[model samples]
Target: MSRRLKNNMLTTIAYVVVLLWLFPMLYMFLSSFKFESQVAVPSLTFTPTLENYRAVVTPEFFKHLNNSVLVTAGTVAVSAILGVLGAYALVYSSLKKANNIYFWFITTIFLPAVAVITPVYIVLAKLHLLDTKLALILLNTGAGIPLMIWMCTTYFKEIPGEIVEAAKIDGCSKAGTFFKIMLPLIKNGIISSALLVFIVTWNEFFFAVTATATQSATLPVYMSKFMTQQGYFWGKMSAAGTMVVIIPILIGFFTYKSLVRGLTAGSVKG
Candidate 1:
């Protein structure tokens, strides 16, 4: 085939694959609007209504939403604070050349969270943090901190050393320089990392499902209730699932432009 034709063929293949990957999301979205009785009759002929959305607006739904929001907000706040502090320390401290410390920090990224759940559960149980938002907040922040630090450190390390020197020369304290200069400079990175942390916390199932009971259950755990002892409640499940899926996605969308720039900020010099 000619090069132009080959390029067109590749483009076509890419579009096909993209559509294939999106098919399930599209199906779930459509099925979510469907009533339980209409689920079996899979046709697009029925008019889409706010019935499912209405179902999602109940007190129970709001309770789960509130829990999710609380956990996600707490996780993002804690993670961002710790990430910024940790990243700044690692970059500016005497241990900058300590490869062992850096290596351990980087290695934490590879540790499967499931491996640590037992210890976390024991600790939480002992502290009476089980079935509490505080437990999820602390756990999610700790779980996400490794990656948050990694991203923040990479971005912070790329910052010009002259800026720090300039800040110090201006009689700025270390903490002042960090808060005034570095924080503003790396705001994008902070937002990006916070968004990612929020996404992970919002969709957190294993920890939320296992650690929390109904009182503190997040959206993911609450939605799981749709799968009853007898069988699945497809309508309610779809409604809950759709709601659960949209919040973080909407959060990402709002910050997406900044996040893209932040993720790539250090990758290019000019």
Candidate 2:
């Protein structure tokens, strides 16, 4: 094919791919404001309403929102803090023995969460933490750490050892090297990881479903059960889903520009 034709073809394909991926989300958005009869009508001629969104903003709705915020914040905070420190240790420490001994920490990611849930549940139950905010936070943190470490490590590794050496020559202690010299250097990684981890924990369903009771139910679990209780109340369910979806997307939009810049924050700084 000619270059012009190929370019046109690629553009068309890109449009199709984007539309294909976005089709469901589009439907979900549209359905959020639809009445039950209009929800699956397969036509766009009908008028939309705000009833669903109004219902989604109720006290019950805020309950789920609060649950989501708690879990997401807890997960992101724990993961970012631990991930930063762990990556710092990996980047700076000379304890080869420690490396081998804790290589298993990274391997925890490969294990399916389902594989560990039974024991985790037993332990949490024994501790009376089942269905509590703490259980979700700790579990989400555990799942988030490996990926957080991997992302943070890449950014930390790119930092120059000379900077760390200079800090030492300046009579800086280990604490200073990390908090003063290194942490700022990897702030982008922290931002990237924090945003990404918050998104993940916000959407996480597995443990949120299994471990949390109604008292701590997240948006996903709330939406999942909302449909059943609604008895084919498609509009309300879709509205709830849209609420859950839109908040994170807005969060991303507000932060992603900063996140991209942050990811490369200190690469060339003196």
Candidate 3:
């Protein structure tokens, strides 16, 4: 085939793949505006209504939304701080077994949350932290740290050793150099990591469902209430899902450039 024809074929394939990927999200968006009676039928013939959106905006929904925001923010902040420090130490420190320590950190990421959840639950119960936002915050922060460390470490390693050496020779303390010099240079990586952590924590369901009850339930947990003995409240659930999706979408859109740059920074050594 000619090069132009091949390019056209590739573009068509890309569009098809994108539409397939977006189909479910598009369905959900359309379903959110559907009336309860029309939700049962998949056809697009029915008139759209606002009742589902209205139903999902109760005070309780707002409370759950607040809980989600708090937990996600806390998890991101804690994970970023600890991950940056840990990654820095692993890359820059002169410890004899730094590689071994880095490998150990990476191993934690492979362990499934379900495998360790029992012990975590017991510990939290003993600490009387169950059903509190703090419990979720701490759990998410710890869970997120491994990936954050991995990302930050990769980015940090890409920094030239000469820069760090220069900072040291200039009498900069390790902490000062990290905060003032290294962080600004890797700001994109940090923001990307924060966004990733926020998205993960925001949508996290297993820990939220297991560790929390009424007082600290997040948006995902709140949406679960739509399923009852009677049946699923499909319209309201769709509406809630749509609303919950907006924050992350907006964040990803606004930070798309930095996220792409940071994620791809150390991939190639050109």
Question: How would you encode candidate 3's per-residue C-alpha lDDT over 134-247 as one tens digit per residue?
Answer: 999998987789879888888898888999999999999988998898999899988898888898899999999999989999999999999999999999999999999999
Expressed as tens digits, the lDDT of each residue in 1-270 for candidate 1 is 899999999999999999999886677788788887786677887767667777667898789889989988888888888877887778778875755665677798787879999999999999999999999999888767876887888888888999899998999998898888888898887888878878878888999987998888988887787788888777777777777778767877888988988888856642
Question: Which residue ranges in model 2 land beyond 4 Å of their true spot?
Answer: 1-12, 97-103, 229-232, 261-270
1-270: candidate 2 lDDT, tens digit per residue: 899999999999999999999999999888888888888798877798999888777897798899999888888888988888887777678868656634676788788889999999999999999889899999999978876876776777777889988998999999978888778877766887788788878889999999988888889888876557437778888888888888789888888876886666534432
Top of the candidates by lDDT? 3
Give the range of the ten consecutive residues with the poorest summed lDDT in model 1. Answer: 96-105
After TM-score superposition, what is the CA distance of residue 72 in candidate 3 from its true location, in Å? 0.5
Alpha-carbon RMSD of each model: 2.8, 3.4, 1.7
Q: Show where candidate 3 strays beyond 4 Å.
A: none
Q: How many clashes (backbone N, Cα, C below 3 Å) per candidate?
A: 0, 0, 0
lDDT, candidates in the order shown: 0.82, 0.83, 0.91
- lDDT at residue 151 of model 2 (Cα atoms): 71
Residue 67, candidate 2: C-alpha displacement in angstroms? 1.3
Off by over 4 Å in 1: 1-14, 37-42, 47-51, 266-270
Report the C-alpha displacement of residue 119, candidate 3, in angstroms.
Answer: 1.5
